[model samples]
Target: MTAKRSKVAPRVATGGGALVPLPVGLSEKEAAQEAYRRLDRRVHARLGAAVGGVSVIGLAQAWGDWASHLALSPGKQMELVWKASRKWQRLAGALGRDPDSE
Candidate 1:
């Protein structure tokens, strides 16, 4: 007879060597967000400036888009939100898949 495993399975390695698990029923988006947060911390430790620069660029782009629509057409902001949401969803799906399958 063998002993059954009990703890939640860890998905990624943290910088300080901590193990963390995604909840069993996390949605793809939520899981991806969690994974990104975890990975970002590790990446930040290694490439803090580069990560900060890229993040600043992303924020600037988002702010520009929001400001552009905020004046001329506020309704279109919703579209931007959906577009970003879809991009994240795609990212989530990609994260959940077998990387070698592509």
Candidate 2:
């Protein structure tokens, strides 16, 4: 007796009643390169916007602090001045500048 192998039919029927394989045109390398290009542009744009926002906020805070000092008493004003000077010294040190020299 000869053994017969049965053929499997398509799970889903197409318009022509034929099974068509899914199409994937791009190779792995090409797909990865395309994805990286898109991601890089998106990340760079977001980072630029964030940096700009931080800079604007810093400027606004500095201006507001300066304006509020105008209404302070002489003793209180001096205290604010000392505090600001210390903050400046710390900022300079963080930037690799010598706080005591200049």
Candidate 3:
């Protein structure tokens, strides 16, 4: 009599990367903020001085509008503004403008 064969699963070769799942607890607003922050990083890296003027101004204004929807504390608001100001200064410096002038 033939021996019964055990069920076997197919195996794939190594070297391909696996997909990672995002954390389960992140909220929609937090996700959008993270996306915006990443996009800003890419923009600053690629555009440099060209982003210092109108685009940055528009970004600040957009932040103001979006921020109003969140119930952030005064301290948190200040922290966000402070971080934005630093980036603005860096951009201004790239453009050869006096950062203090803004």
Indicate which candidate wins on lDDT.
1
- Between candidates 2 and 3, the one scoring higher on TM-score is 2
lDDT of each: 0.73, 0.62, 0.60
Give lDDT tens digits, candidate 1, residues 1-102.
544432544365677787678766565656667889979877776775756656666777999997876869756777888999999999999899997888
TM-score of 2: 0.29
RMSD of each: 18.0, 18.9, 18.7
Clashing pairs in 2: none
lDDT of 3 by residue, 1-102 (tens): 544332332222222443333334455555445556655765676676666545766888988977785555787878889999999998887899766888
Clashing pairs in 3: none
TM-score (all chains, Cα) for each model:
0.31, 0.29, 0.27
Q: Residue 15, candidate 1: how far off, in angstroms?
A: 32
Residue range with the least summed lDDT across 10 consecutive positions in model 1 = 1-10
lDDT of 1 at 95: 91
- Candidate 2 lDDT, tens digit per residue, 19-51? 443224544454445556655766666866877
